[model samples]
Target: MNHTTFETPVVSRARTVERLVAGQPTSDGAGVKLTRVLTNTLQRRLDPFLMLDAFGSDNPGDYIAGFPDHPHRGFETITYMIAGRMRHRDSAGHEGLLSNGGVQWMTAGRGVIHSELPEQEEGRMEGFQLWLNLPAKDKMRDPWYRDIPSGEIPEFTRDGVQVRVIAGASHGVPGAVQRDQTEPLYLDLHLEPGARFEQTLDPALNAFVYVYRGGLSIGDTAVPVQRMALLANGGDTQGIVLQAGEQPTRALLIAGRPLNEPIAQYGPFVMNTRDQLMQAVEDFQNGKLA
Candidate 1:
């Protein structure tokens, strides 16, 4: 018999919130209203993470048309639903429904065309879409998709704090969605009033937190809904501590290993160089990109 043991080092130092950026109101994909939290203008791309968009609206007029067919390559798209439902159909003949608490991870390696539309005619629709950059070597790989339901996602609770592990380990429990290339961490945290949550992270990775509900204090700095806090590099220490205010709070913690490579982006195509970007354009124009 063989035995394996995993251990996480205890670090006393905590990573502090470096900066806060307010989300910008924007519209995209057949006129769906969204708040762009992270954009190229913010930091000229945050290593492996390209963009984060939060789409939430109770009025059907704000999101009725939904995202029409679009093509993408050399990256991945992650859709996590907090409310309502979205139906997705891709060129690879894959279809999925992302309901409240559901998630869809789509890897547009070489190319892919997809559409996301609301499942209901009227009501609330709310969710997030994140774009992750792929390494140059894996840019031309085959497309892949992973759809995970809310129940399948692992959750852990302790001391009035609950954490849903979406794409990495939390409290010794691993998430359902794992990608070998980027090795990202996505966590949804809910903190009861006056509760505190803490976690250790990889020092080499880039990390950020997005507050969606209530208020939280990140190392003495107060953060509210629709605001994003970018964390400083851990350096010698790789831990973060967050405390909830009087009201209950909800936030997302995301981190990813940095690729540290040149980026060339054009609309839906992201590549390593101008030539590659031009090739991607030609591929889509000739119908080679699906």
Candidate 2:
């Protein structure tokens, strides 16, 4: 609910881009076209963070079918809708409409069956769905869900840059939600032409930035549109600095405390070991996953 304005933070040693990756073209949710920015391959390196999928399309045919009833366990899903509308229904009896600039945060603690279907027949459906892993002790916790309207999220503007704190604190501004296990930091940055922004981050957290509109620079690395730059981690860097070029740019900056725990994933289910995964599958098959 914070529409406050503030000055940008100072970063003494900004983290540079370790790898520049182009999102892979893929489809999910009953044929919804999207770009998989964070794939399964990087799960280990990212830890607590599992996947980040970006989807945007003007053609209704591309996203109309939406995501059918799907089972998820041992993790959380944060769907940020940039445009259009989608209805969500889950086994836990939670339902909501995610419209433009809204977020649907759901935790499939032990397990849950859900569906995300488009509420529109035409126009654009643009958004990002991020999957975050749970800690071993809390993997089987009860399911939880929350719908966050755009205005409810805490945000601040500094100069020409606007920072939306989705999950963690930014420049003394707390986000809409917080998690103790991962201490995740999710920010949506909107920068005007020639604007510069800076954020302070814990050196121990793993971090990355995905440029969705226009392009920007991180140190010497040029992050173009549709590209994700994995930030280098270490005690050497204090945070990150972002500067927009001639044109306005928008991006998602995400970081999180590493779980450093073993990750066992089998499709929709993510657990601690192979045996646990098998048990999850069995639970789903037996209609007990929810």
Candidate 3:
């Protein structure tokens, strides 16, 4: 008698796009025109993530003034440049210049005052600012900053897909930015026409994809530019799969472990309780935040 060995088929868990969000126009940071992708209206908060803004314009009038003298606390801010340059200076004596393909990761734990201005006078200024929430335990830890140049960022290419890892691992390659609390996954992906990209993620983490250019197929649904695809809870799923349209496509894929704690936020401060929120305000007003 002859016996044959059988192989088990691998099952890929693809998170379904729960909803499609059309970015809304909003002016922030000294008359900067940007599209707000994830905001308070979108489910109060997305666990460890707070907000995402896509800002870009060839016209100088749209983004020249830039963000001057701002205060933040209890969270983190990530600025990734795509087309232009931005200079960041904070009260912690931290200064960074984020040019094309550069990144600035700022953690305003206790408190921080900073300013972000364009490094150029006339040209295209384009970038994305992502707000990541800090857990209550880490909220009052300490302020820190990480400046990553374009040349330092790790980029992985396979077939027709290119992935730039900023805060997590992709294709077994780790990113430059690191956070022990959140353990977030942030990837900038570009795909050629008809290309496909897939990666497994922590099943307990919340994830989403924001399309910035061209179109893509997430699962079976089609997503266009300036739109966000919120993923369902991983549950039994293993990973996410995406396919590009006829044209090239670009997007940001982010995921993080959910804190599952109460959130109290006011302006630039995000705390655990209303009293903490008020304290943050008082600290800033009393010039104690630095």
Top model by lDDT, which number?
2
Counted clashes in each candidate structure: 2, 0, 0
- Expressed as tens digits, the lDDT of each residue in 59-168 for candidate 2 is 99999899999999999999999999999999999999999989999999999999999999999889999999999998999999999999898988878988888998
Estimate every model's Cα lDDT from 0 to 1: 0.87, 0.92, 0.87
**Full ranking by TM-score:** 2, 1, 3
What tens-digit string does per-residue lDDT give for candidate 3 at 1-290? 11122222233877889889998899998999998888876534468888899999999988999999989999999999998988899999999888999989999999999999998889899889999999888899789999999888888777688888899777667788777868889999999999988878777888889988899998888989888998888479877899999999999999988888887889899998999999999999999986
Position 123, candidate 2: lDDT: 91
- List of clashing residue pairs for candidate 2: none
Model 1 accuracy (lDDT, Cα): 0.87
**Deviation of model 1 at 250, angstroms:** 0.4
lDDT tens readout by residue for model 1, 1-290: 11123234354787888899999999999999999999977434367999999999989999989999999999999999999988999998889999999999999999999999998988889989999999999999999998899988888677788888889776677787777767889999999999988788877778889999998998978988889999888578667888899999999999888888888899999999999999999999999976
Candidate 1: RMSD to truth: 3.2
- Superposed by TM-score, candidate 3 places the C-alpha of residue 107 at a distance from the truth, in angstroms, of 0.5
